[model samples]
Each structure stands twice: as C-alpha cells, then as structure tokens.
Target chain A: MDIDLILKAINITVIGYIIVFVVLFLLYLSFYYLAKLLESQAKERCRRAGKNKCAEHDKFSVDSDTTAAIAMALYLHFGETHDIDSTKLTMKRESKRYTPWNSKIYNVIHRL
Target chain B: MEGLYRFLEYTGFANFTFGHGIMIIVGLVFIFLAIKKDYEPLLLVPIGFGIILGNIPFIQNAGLNLGVYENGSVLRYLYFGVLSGVYPPLIFLGIGAMTDFSTLISNPKLMLLGAAAQLGIFATFLGSIFLGFNLNEAGAIGIIGGADGPTAIFLASKLANGSNGNLNLIGPIAIAAYSYMALVPVIQPPIMRLLTTKKERVIRMKPPRSVSKVEKIIFPVAGLLLTGFISPASLPLLGMLFFGNLLKESMVTERLAETARKPMIDIVTILLGLTVGASTQADIFLTKQSVLIFILGALSFMVATAGGILFAKFMNLFLSNENKINPLIGSAGVSAVPDSARVSQLEGLKYDKNNHLLMHAMAPNVAGVIGSAIAAGILMSFLL
Candidate 1:
C-alpha cells in the first residue's frame, strides 16, 4: 500500500539476495580448489607408487574411458549391492585380467 | 429412537466441529510424515500425536489436571516448555556435542559464506516488518530464514516472551523453518543449476590439507570469543556449539561427545517436537496469518540460496584458477546440516563425478548455523 515502504522492502530483499549469492560463490570456490588439490595428490600418490617403468606406462594408458567403466561397475555393483564380499568376488570373476595395480586403483575409486 | 438419541448425546458425536476435524487430519499428516516419510520422526511423531490429542473435542476434562483453571490445559503445560525456550537450547547442547568443527577449521574461509547466507534472515526480518508485523513478531518470523529449528525457537521464545508471556508465533515459525529445511534437496538444486553452467559445476576442487590439532582446538574457542564480542546475545548458542566442537577435537572425552551427540539430542528432539506440535491447536493454527507465515518462510529460503549463488559469481572477478567454484554449494550455507551439503554434492556430481562437494560444503553449512544464531541473537537484543 505504501510505495516508499514497498521500495524499501524490495531494496532490502535485493541486498539479502546478493549476500546469499556471495556466500555460495565462496563455497563453490573453496570446494573447487579443494577437489583440485585432492586430484593432484591422488595423481602424485599414483606416480610415486608406480615408480617402475611397466607400471608407469600402464597408469598413463589406463585412460579416462577405462576409469569411467570401472567407476560405473564399482558403483552399480559394489556400492548399490552393499555386499562388499560378494562385489569383490564378482569383480575378481569378471575382471580376471585385473592386476594388483588394477586392484589398487579399484580401492582408490571405492574410497571416493 | 429416544435411546439412539441419548446414546449419540452421551458419546458427544454430535459435538464434533469443522476445526476439530481439520486438526485431526493435520495431526494425521504430521504422523504420516514422521513415520512413513521419516521426516524428523523423533519430534514429528510425538508432536503429531500431541496435536491429535489436543484437538479432540470434549476430552479437555479427562482427569488430566488437578483442577480446571483459566490458563491451564495439558497441551498448555507441554506448550509452556517450548514457550519458555527451555527445550530448544538444551537441544542445542546436544547438537553442539554431535557437530564436528574440524570441517570448519580445515576450511575457515567458508565461514564468510555462512555469514553471507544469513542475508535471508535479515531480508525476511525487514520483509515481515513491512508486512505489518511489529519488531518482535518480525524477528520471530524472520528466523525461519535461518532454517535452524532450535535457534528459531530460542529467538522466538526470547523475543515473543521474555520471562513468562504468551506469544503464539513460535509454532508456525518452527514448523515452517523445519519443513523448508527438510525440503532442501527439493528446493536448492534448480536454483543452483539455473545460476551456473555445466562448466562451472564440473570445476574440480583441490582437497583440503590436513588441519593441525592445535588449529582445531583453537578454532572453536577463537570463534566463540570473536562472535561473542561482535554479538554478545549469540554467546549461549556459539558457546555451546564451540564447546561441543572442542570436546570432539580434544578427543579426551569420547563418552561426553557420544552423550552430546546421541541420546541427549534424541530426547530433546522428542520433547521439542511434541511441545511445538501441541502448541499448534486449531484455534491458533487456523488463521490467514499462519498461511502467510509459510509463504514468507519459503521466500526466505529462496532468497538465501540466490544470495549465495550471486555472491559466488561476484567473487569470480578477483581470482584466476583452473578450478573455479561451483556456486551450488553456497545454498548449503543455510543451517540445514548435511542436507543442503548433500544437495550441493548431488548437483556437483551431476556435472562431474569427481566433484565431491559434501565435506567442502560442510564448512559453510556448519558456519551457517553459527551465523543464523548470531543474527537471531542480534534481533533478540534489539527487539526484546
């Protein structure tokens, strides 16, 4: 009913709205940085663990595609199934070609 | 026919009213949400049952009281515990024990976001005032923006009634705040997606460095001192919160921490929920103003989310890194605990599977609890 009062309300609401945006922005930035740090650390850990020439070459070629497939399978079967022992058995049966290094990678993915 | 009429009269079946019927249904819905939906079940179930009991007609004098007095009812007695602000803060002591401040200490910058998210409270406060609510009423209403039920109750009890007074706004406010909080997953995502693109959402974050034990111990104590200096009214809440955190970090009192986190929080939640629900009788709840309270409460949540997202966009100006933040986590700054953080994680995962935003978002999520309490205390001091 009062134009000045309505305008003031709008102003306050706008300011309040802006404040929320700023906070979210900061949180996003913090998470983004945190994730990058974790990824780098994981990569470094992988590099250090794979000091041998054979392991280093395999690690590089594992590729994003293989990682995705492994991740999907692990999450769908292992995570959703909720039977860790059974999932491990299934993984061993399905991926008989899995190396000790592959198991290590699986462990890392499962942790995530 | 005469016998049938006498039976009906004795049974009081003819005395049932529309209000009683409506309240019964409302109580049933609360029960359903509590039991079936598992929505804050510990509190909601008792509160729901209490509401049903309070609303049943002709049951007011069922030998429940010593004598009929002008202001005494079984519901009123239970409601007084809520009105006096007794249950909510004691509940906070338990919450303090349950909460781990390490997430916050590991990432202190998120505290700013927590503070930023509280724009919702102040905005809603001013909005309620314009909506023709007096300062105390506006403060009570605005706390819904904080999205913390205990803080809302504490502030409402203080502002609406100092030592002993009857102000009927706390029930609706608490209900609205908790309801919205539970709905964080439903409420936060669309806003987050609309504001940020896939590029931003997929932005990878570096994992936090391990925080030193010294930093963890100093954090809660320093936080209390700093926040208390700024707003003394916030000391009780901030003090309890930091104390709980200190107990967890100190690691010497595992038993005390366990007590604070589990049975203690559980017991208080039941009492608080029932007391709140019992306070919401049909006579009080069936008002146009109550409906408006819910609407305003939702608006507050939306505004709070928007504020966080926009602020993130603004921050983009100062920094240049490959890992820009996904603004969605800003919504976690509203004190819903882990729910809003979970929502942020889900949204981030949608863009990039590797984006584990939960632990990171937790920093602001917990900080938002402190921020809202501070804001509430400020409101109480000024208004009361």
Candidate 2:
C-alpha cells in the first residue's frame, strides 16, 4: 500500500496504453497505404485491358454467376483482376472455328 | 505367496507412490483424449505414451534415471530438443509448403490487419515485464499473442535460458497457444459479434482479381527481404518459411515440396509433441506460475483479436463506403493461419450469406505469420 509504488504502477500503465495507441496508429497508416496502392493497381490493370478508361466507369462488368465463380478463383490465384477483353476474345475465337459438334464441318467452315 | 510378492516388488507396484499413480491416470486420460476425441492425435498419442513410460516407478532401468541426488534427470535431455528452438521451425517449413499464399497475395491490404493483430504481443510483453519477469521472459510470454505454437516455443526456449535454465515453460506456452487456436470457432464469434454490428459483419468485400504467377513468386521473396531487414532475428523462421513457399511456387522441387508438406512435418510434430509433453512432469507443471501462464496466454489472444478489430473500425472513418473493410477479418491477424481466417469468414457469412471475406481475410491471416515472426525476432535481438 505504499503511495509511491502505487503512483509508479499508474505511470507504467499509462505509458503502456500510450505505446499501444502509437503502434495501432502506425498499423493504420500502413494498411491505408497498402489499400491505396492496391486500388490504383486495379484501376491501371483495368485501363490496360481497355475496359474503363478511368476510375469512374463500369467497363469491366461480367454476368453475375460467371463473375462470382471466376472472381473467387481468380482472386485466390492471382490477387488482381483478369483482363476481361483478352479472356473473352480467346473464348470467342476458340468456340467459333473449333466447336466440338461441328468437327466434320471444319473444312467447309474454314473455306467459308 | 513369496513368488507373487517377489513379482509385485520387481514391477515396483509394492513401492508405488501417490505421484506415480497420478501420473499414470493423467497419461491414461491423455491416451483417451488422443484415441477417442482425436485431440491432436499425432503428438498427443506419443506424448501420452511417453509420459506413462517415464512415470513408471524404477523404470530407472529404461532411461528413467531421475537423479534423485542431482538437479537434473534423463527426461531433461529428451526435453532439450524442444528447448533448443529446433523442431518448431522445421514444423513451420512444412506448414509453409502446405499453405497456399495465393489468398494473401490476392489481397495484400489484409497484411495490415495481420500486423495490427500483433498489438496483443506488445501489450502482453509490457504486462509481463510489469509482473516482474525480466526482458527475456517477458518476450517469451508475449509471443502467445501471436497464437502460433512453434513461434511461442522458439521464443520461450530462447528467453527461458541462462539463470532460469528451466526450459519447461515452452511446453505450457505451446500447448496453450495450439489449444486456443483450435478453439477459434468458439472464442472468436462472440467477440466479433459484440464489437461489430450485424450490418458491419455482413459487409461484402469486392472480389480481388487474378494475380500473376510472377507476382506470386516475387511476393514471399520481397516479404522476407523487407521483414528480415527490419528484424533479422526473424530470419530463421521467416527465411525458412518463405524458402519453403518459394520451392512450392517455383514448381521445380515437386519432390521436396511434397516431402516438406506431409511426412517431414508429421514426423517433426510427433517428436515435438512427445518431447514437449514429457517435460510436463508433475513436479514442474503443477504450480501457481504455470496456471498464471495459461491464463495470461488466453488473455493475450483475446487482446490481439480485439486490437485488430478496433484498428479496422478506426480505418472505416476514412474509407469510402465501398472500400471500408469488414472488421471481422481483423481477428484473423493472429497467425493461426486459415483457422483465424475461417473464423472471420464464418462470422461474416452469419450476417450476409452472399458476403465472402475468406480470401480477403487470408491476406492478413498469412501476413500475421510474418508479423509475429518479426516481433519474435525483434524480441530475440533486444532480449537475448
């Protein structure tokens, strides 16, 4: 019950609280910077893909189901958005000239 | 009658004491928990068996030299493996191989949440120092905040050396950390619910896009360089972790990666568990301080989770409505890996079934492993 000891304990506790706040503040700033960087990168990738010219447009929309499934897998694997135009173009080119059911019509289709 | 008496005496039943009986019962319970409940069966089963074997009176013949006269015993050597900071890092390497870092790279911002979660480590460190532990002991005790078993053991072995040569503290610390990790589902939800309203919990994060393979390969290497430069003591654990990860991503060392992920890790876990549990003899484990350590471990975990969540809430003030993070994922920053992340996801799903926070949360979840290791390294350099 020494008054001096009690005061010392209070001082230590206050210091500890202050330190926690400081560390937490630093952590907040680090995350803010990281998130800002990620957002900018996402926008840049979208631009490179010829989707939205700027951040204020919706040039990269996909159907809901396809978006959900592909989004999850792509994010898990790549950590960034897929280039929408390239993927779609690849799919279209593959389907038209090489449809599986029309294998026998391939020569005629190629001529056409 | 004489033959029967002779057989009983030879088996040491005639000389059985209360301590021996208690240890046997404890071992039996450990066996039951392992076999029936499957509670960490790989290590628990061996440890249970080792405890029973070590406790058998006069098994002094079977390496039970208790050194009634000396301060140390044979069990001391077996326990030394855990105390030297060997097995746990090897176990970490295995974990690194098995883990999928794609979730983390896909959402790098979550790494901040992981770093925020380490607030518990520093808080507990100060608490322990105020409680009369020296710098080293405080460092060891604080890592319980990381919620990682190997790191706890590694730090404890480093701290609890010298004058307090009692390396036995590692066992309790590790067991407590791993136990709380398994209880994440139970311990985290209420805290998550209380801190975050239903609407906040259910907030949906926009899915991140695909990351390139080059990015994946670069992420761990860059992380190691950055964190290691800041805190070199973290090199042993973090370096090995990223190395194992690099092996997996590089895709050339399929055999080495496969080995690291399974049998190599399994073997180390068994050895590590038995060695750790064997150190918990009745004389050492049954103490007031031991109980305090367990309680403190739980407190550290709670504080770490709270710190992460609160930090996220603070961030919400600045972020646009769409960019504000779901604070539930903040809890995953304690280095328990996918368990803490899964807990965050579950809490998020409870509020919004359509909301998926697992992948996003995983970024912080994985970053926590590195953060805690850096914290440990800093402590090691300062204290040791």
Q: Among these predicted structures, which one has the highest DockQ?
A: 1
B96: Cα error in model 1, Å? 1.8
Assess candidate 2 and give its lDDT: 0.71
In model 1, which regions exceed 4 Å deviation? A1-112, B1-15, B59-75, B161-167
DockQ of candidate 1 relative to the true structure: 0.07
Using alpha carbons, what is the TM-score of model 1? 0.75
Interface C-alpha RMSD per candidate, 1 decimal: 8.0, 6.2
Worst 10 residues of 1 chain A by lDDT: A57-66
lDDT of 2 by residue, A2-108 (tens): 45644443454345334333433344454455546766786787788776465444344333246558867977889555675454433344455676788878867
TM-score of chain B of each: 0.90, 0.88
Model 2 lDDT tens row, B83-140: 6788878888887887777766655556667777887787787676666655566678
Stretches off by above 4 angstroms in model 2 are: A1-112, B1-78, B161-167
Give one digit per residue, the lDDT tens place, for model 1 in B143-167. Answer: 8888888898888877764333435
Per-candidate TM-scores read 0.75, 0.74
